[model samples]
Structure formats: C-alpha cells, structure tokens
Target: VDQGHEVHVAYQTSGNIAVHDWDALRYAEFMLEFSEQHGDISEVEQKLYRKVIKFLRNKKSSDADLPEVRSIKGLIRRGEARAGARFTGLDDNHIHFLDMPFYETGRTRKKPLGEADIQVVADLMQKVKPHQVYAAGDLADPHGTHRVCLDAIFGAYKWLEKESWIKDCWLWLYRGAWHEWAIHEIEMAVPMSPQQLRRKRQAIFMHQSQKDRPPFPGSDNREFWQRAEDRNRDTANTYRALGLAEYEAMEAFVRWKG
Candidate 1:
C-alpha cells in the first residue's frame, strides 16, 4: 500500500492454525492431559477427547461438532480484523480484500478445484483488469491449499483468456513461509533494504495470532517471521553469489508460463 500500487489480497483459506494460540506444543500438552484423565472418561467423553486430539493432530474427525474448528474461525476473524486496522491509516481506496470459502487446517479440506472457484477469480480479474497477478507458488505446502489456490488462479486466467477478457496481464508466482523459490527458478528478484525488511516484519506481526507459535509449523520449528526473513535473506545471498549487486534482502518470484 505504501508503494502507491493497488493491492488486492484473496485469502483462499482461513489459516486457522497460523495463530499463536494453537501451536503444536500446546496440542501436545492437551494430549498429555487427556491421557492422564483417560481412566475417568466416560464412553461419550472418550469419544469427544479422541475427536479433539485427532483434530489437533491435523487429522479429520468423524464428529462435526468439534469446537476446534469454531475456535480457529474466531482466531482467523480477529487476525484479519487486526490486519485491516494496520492499514487503516494508509490509502484504503487502493487496498481490496476478497476472502474465499475454504478450510484452514488439513482436517476439513475443501472440494477439489471447480468451475465456481475459477469463475469467481476470473470475474475478479475481469473487473480489476490488473496489469499483473501474483499467485501462490505451491512449494512444500503439506496441506495442499497452496497447490489448490494456484490451480484456481490458473483456471481463472484460462477462463478469462477464452472469454477474451485477459489482456496483457502477467502472472507472477511467489513462494514463502513454507518454502522459497529455487535459485534457478527466480525470474524477477526484488531487493529490500534493512528498513524495508524491518517494515515487512512489522506488517507480518500485525497477525498477532500468528506471532509466537503457529499451530502448523510443519517440520520447521522456526516462527513464521523468522522463516520469512531467512528465506528472503537467502534469496538475496543467492543473487549476490550469481554476481548480482549485494542486497540486504530479496524476494524472488517466478513468472507463470500459462
């Protein structure tokens, strides 16, 4: 928003577990508490505990009345509201938000990429008529949401093309948080100074729910901010290694072929 460019963010999933309240360590503690009280659990209570544990472990439970899902949604809403507040002083007219209906964790995965999903994005593209579109680069995302999001964006672009609505809009794919783009795959590299990096980190911190310990850290135990900084710095280092001008940090993106 500070760059005087119109920015539209479409969150494909709620990212429920991306908050500080639902970390793996806390889940493990809950499991231990359940185990200690297992003997006193009635048949109905046992089933409830099992369901909770399964959800915590990133597994889908048969029971639909799980409180965890609701809690996740609440966390997501608050985080989004906080994010919006951070940009209140900026040019709100240049910022837009589009949230798609999708699950946060892998437990309640949504349906496969479909026409409706594609159409929604295609309509947005047609309306915006943007010069560029940045889609998610599904890199090492275990839950497959990123891949599905990419597919939806691709489908949307294809739909727009068939309708002759896609003009000269270019698509850029970015990967971060979970993984970074490979050195060979980076087409456009954006250099960031120390102040820029710090500002970026501050923006990330607005999602207070995702600050200290996110629910799904995957195999990487580092916090999301740390992971982001490390990935960006590494990309900058790779660029320098290739004889590019040294930068304090860099964000790499790969242009989508299709």
Candidate 2:
C-alpha cells in the first residue's frame, strides 16, 4: 500500500469549468461544509454567494462572454480536490494543492511552461524527495495541462537527478481521472473493493463543482467521477473479460517517462 512512505500528489488544476451552473451552485453549497477546519461556515460563504446571486438577479442582459469571477470557480475546485483526497485515504498534510501557476488564470488558455511552475514543482520534489512520485499521464488530456505538467515534472526530475536527490525515487504515471491505462499497458493496478469504489465516487463528489457545471469541459456529459469510476470499473471489467480476476474498481498506472 506504500503507507509508510510519504506519497505526494500534485494535482495541477482546479478543474472548475467542467460542470454546469445548477450543479455548480449545489456543489458550492456542499463544499461550504468543508471550507475550513472548523466545518460548516455556510452563513459566511453563502453570504458571499448571495452577493453574486443578487448581482445575477439584476442582470436581465449581460455580456455573453463575461462570466462570474474565477476566484469563485477556483474555490469550488479546491474544495472538491480536498474532498477527493480525503475519500482516497490521503492525509491532508501529504496531499498538496500545487494548483500550478499556469492554471491560475481560469480559462484553458495557458502560457508556456515558465520558471514559476518549474520552481514550484522543483521545490516540492526536493522537499518530499518521495519514495514514489505519481502524476497524471493522460497525453490525451482534452486540455494540454497534463502535457505541460509532465514536462515540468520531467524538467524537475532532471534537475533533481543532477543534484543527486532523486536517483533512488520510484517514478509512476497515472492517467487523468478521464482515462485509464490500457489492459495490456498497465504496470501497476491498484484494485478497489466495493467500499473503495464508493469511496472513489465520494472523492469525485468532492469535485462537485465539475459534476454538473462547465465542469472540466470533457467529451462526455457524465460527471467527472462518473466518467472516472465507470472507466475505472470498466478497466477492471475489461481485465476480467480478458480473463483476469474481477475487482470493484482499479486505478492503473504505468512506468515513468524516464
């Protein structure tokens, strides 16, 4: 389970615009519960949203392109990531929200990899010097964040290697929540029990803002976790259909780029 060794996850983006308005609204409400260590600050956060709701109430007409502030959007996604990590048995301290510099601007449009992003990753890698480093390897990521993230990680790894800090680290690649490693290609498959499947779904729920809103703007209409779990379950089923033992769910991985 790699429990004793520190495992660090640097999810690169907030995945805010992946769902719809109604879903975003509801998710924002649920997220209010976990916004702080104290829990359930609906009075205060909802008060903030009320200002927006009130503002939207007056808009009989508005700029088609202009939308709500990105800070609100980023807020929901961060809460979702927090919830997802909790569902996966990830300790809050071990999970990091790099929320990479390039993703700070809400839109998918991004600038090239810069020192800001490289330094954040480099600092984390050096700080953790983890026994294992796992990252999203969805070369097919609808957005190029995965590609850019991989580039930054590889760049950091190269720096670490030269610094003599990461030669002993085990590297692993995880497909985005969108995709999974092919049956024949998986190097490591973490099987999930029925309970874990539910937990994964729960984690996906943490990203509620993406569930029904402009969420991650994916190819499918299904919520992110729905798509993720179905794909995960299906991957496991595919394995079983191909004559492997059945499992409730499976998050598969492959070898590192190096």
Candidate 3:
C-alpha cells in the first residue's frame, strides 16, 4: 500500500469459534452496563445482550455458544481485524470478512468445504482483480482452519484460472507462527528493521480480545505477537548463518504456482 499498490485484507471466516465463552460473557456484560448507564443503546440491542449474557452464563464448557453469542464474538474479531487494518493504513472498504458458509457452524469443527465457500472467495478475487494473492499455507495448524481456508482459495483460483486476469495474478503462501518455510523452500525474504518490527507488534496489539491469554494459545504459552517476533528474528538469524546480510527480522514467503 505504501508503494501505491492497492492492498486488501480478507478474512475467510468469522473466527467466532476462537473467542472464549468467558470473553463473550464479559463483553456482553460490559455492553449491558453501558446501555443502562448511557441509555443510548436501543432496547433491542439491550435485550439481545441480556439473552447472550444469560445463555453464556448457563452454557456448558462442552456446548457450543448460542447463535447470538457467537455473533457477538464474531463482531469482536471483526472489530479487531478492522482496527488492525486501519492501523496498518488501510481503509474500511479494503478489509473484507468473507464469513464462508463452512465456518458458520459456530463450533470448532467446521463443515466440509463447499462450492458456496469457494464462490465467496472467488467473488472477492473477481472484485479486486488483485495482482497478488497471499494465502495461508500453514497446514500444521492444530485448529485446521488454515488448511480449510487455503483449500477454499485453491478452489477459487481453479475456478478463475481461465479468466484474463488470472495470468497476471500471483499467489503467495505464508506459514503461521507454528511453522516456517524451510530455508531452501523460501522463495522470498523481506527484511524488517527494529522500528518496523515494533510497528508490527503495535499493529497486532490492536486485537485486544486476543491479548494476554488467547483462547487457543496452542502449545506455546507466549502471546501471538511474541511468537511472530521470535519467528521473524529466527528467520533472520538463519539467513545470517547462511552468509547473507544480517537483518533485525525477516518475513519469509513461498510463491505458489498452479
């Protein structure tokens, strides 16, 4: 975006399942309290919050969140995403939430990838006609959302392969914090300065709901930002060991050819 190229961030799912029930309940309670004190919130909104609070309070740890509660959680994630994007200098119009049908199950186990989900991604590709598409290539994610989302993008890419813009569009695969591309497999390495890394951390900090103890902390107890920073610095160290110029941090990506 800084280079005058258009950029858009698309989230394939609502990410509602990742939000903890306790977090949702706390947010609901806060909203209800705010509504009571300010009297600015609509009656409908207040009633919905009340229902969500009540349902979440009684919800079992094994039970899925109520639809309303799930929606609230989804909203929280969406707001965080938008804030992060804005912090990175993107307009609201450029940030998209596909909320693919397969991921709307409101459970940790999502539905099988279907045509509707692929079409949602395809529609965005058609609309943007982007020159570059970055997809999550992290198949090792414990939650499996990354693999499903990547499959959706692959489906969309195949569906649009005959289009005129397809020839110009390049797909790039990025691994998550859990894994990094092998040194030889990495097609590109973008170096980052200390200042740039600090800014990256700040951008990630926009997701307040994910701060401290994230619902899915995985095996690593460190926060998401810490994981990211460590991963980048480790990549840079690997490059340095290979006799390359040293950098404070580096982001690695592998270009996908289909």
Candidate 4:
C-alpha cells in the first residue's frame, strides 16, 4: 500500500520451533521433564498449549535449563502446535498467512518434497501474479529445511511453466540465518537507513518466542537480532568496499536463473 504494490508472504513452514535434531531433542527433553514432574504425559501437551500464553504474559521460561527429549516425532508435533500459536498471536491486520502443510521433519532427514507442496505454491503464484518471488538460498543449511523450501518453490514454478500459467516473475534467492550471499554473487543490494534498520529490528522483535536465547543459535552465539544486524551491516560494508555508497545496513539477494 505504501509503494502502491501488493505484498504477500508465504511461509513454507510455520517455522515450527527448533528444527535441528539437537534442538528437537532438547525440546522433547524439556517436555518429558515437565511430564515427569507432573506425573502425567498429558501435562506435556498442556504445557505446550500454554507456552504462547505464558510468553504473552511475560512469563516465558529460560531456554538454558530445559531438558532434552529423545522422541523426534513427538517434538515435531509439539513444535508445530507451538508455531501455530505463535504465528496466530503475532498476526497483523496487513499480513495474511497461507495455510501450508507443516512438514515436521528436522535435521535427521528431508521430508520427501511432493506435488502437493508444489501445488500450494503454484496456486499462490497464479493468484498473486507477483512480479518477484523469493526463495531461501541456504542450500547447505545444516538443518536442511531451507533447501527443502527452495526445492518446493522451484517445483511450483516449474509446474506453472508447464501449465503455461506462469507470469513474467523474477525469482530471487536469499540466505537464511546460517549464511549470506558472497559479495561477488550478490545481484541486488537494498540499502537500509537508520530508521528502516530500527523498524526491521522491531519487526523481528515481534517473534518473541525466538528471542533471548533461541533453541538453536548455531555456532554464532549472538541473538537473532544481533546476527541479522551484523549480516546487514557487513553487506553494506562489502558494498562500500566495492566503491558503492555507504549505507547504514543492506540486504543482498541473488537473482535465480530458474
């Protein structure tokens, strides 16, 4: 609306909490511990049900002391439930959330990408007829979900092309938390002013469940906000090094040929 353009976001996954194997295990463990203490397995479900509520009430639990569970499937389900609640709570009047399947698999293995997943995306593309589409570029993400998501988008685009319903859309790939596009590989670098940077940080802050200490911070100990700021600033610096105008922050993207 601000730029006289429609903005729509499609999340392949609801960002079901910690998708890494280790993180999943940690979450499972925590739930198991809660079950054990309450002397009933049902309590585990109850606890997760209240997680978003507790967070909203400013009584979120610290991640450091959570126990680790061995059940991956159980954890995946719990994560999806938690993610749904979190997303619903954070819903804004301007943004619409599409109902996509939550393939609740983590680092252990890849969820078999299927036509259904591709079709969902294809339908969205046909409906939106967007001039641009962005897919995750972190093909080597240790957790694997990013790569899966990218493949799904590719599949959707291919399907649309086959049906002759494809629009003249430009596809862009963006890396996730694990990595950023190399300076030489960047095709588009968007500069962010100080106020824009602050606004971006505030938008990120809305995902309160992911703040403080996320379950899987990876090798980088910094919080998500810190990591994002550093990456954006680094991209800006890299652009400056190449004799571009200095910017407070920058987000780089690579144009995808496919």
Compared with the true structure, all predictions reach lDDT values of 0.68, 0.69, 0.90, 0.64
Instruction: Tell me the deviation in Å of residue 221 in model 1.
Output: 0.5
Worst 10 residues of 1 by lDDT: 16-25
Clashes of each: 2, 12, 0, 3
lDDT of 2 at 117: 83
Ranking by TM-score: 3, 2, 1, 4
lDDT of model 4, residue 103: 53
TM-score per prediction, in order, is 0.73, 0.76, 0.96, 0.69
In candidate 2, what are the lDDT values of residues 1-258, reduced to their tens digit? 235655556766555444344444554454544564466566767677565555434433332212453555566667777777776767888777776777665456777888778878888888877777887788877778789988988888877787665877767888755667767788899888998778667766776555564435558677666777787888788888888898988888898758
Count residue pairs with overlapping backbones in model 2: 12
Query: How well is each residue in 72-177 modelled by candidate 3, as lDDT tens digits?
Result: 9999999999999999889899999999999888777889999999999999999999999988898878788898999999999999999999889999997765
Where in model 3 is the C-alpha error above 4 Å? 40-44
Error of 3 at 56 (Å): 1.5
Q: Which is superior by lDDT, 2 or 4?
A: 2
- Backbone clashes in candidate 4 total 3
Task: Please report the TM-score between candidate 1 and the true structure.
Answer: 0.73
For model 1, the superposed segments whose C-alpha errors exceed 4 Å read 17-78, 81-99, 102-106, 163-165
Clash-forming residue pairs, model 1: 19-209, 20-209
Whole-model alpha-carbon lDDT for candidate 1: 0.68
lDDT top scorer: 3
Tens digits of per-residue lDDT, candidate 1, 1-258, equal 566766665555556544432443364356557766676556775565556556656644353424554554454655554575454434444344444445432354566667766776777778878888887795578677788778888888877776554657889988778788878788998999998898878877777666666656678888778989999999999889988899999988899878
lDDT of 4 by residue, 52-80 (tens): 33433342343321222223434454444
The positional error of residue 63 in candidate 3, measured at the CA in angstroms, is 1.5
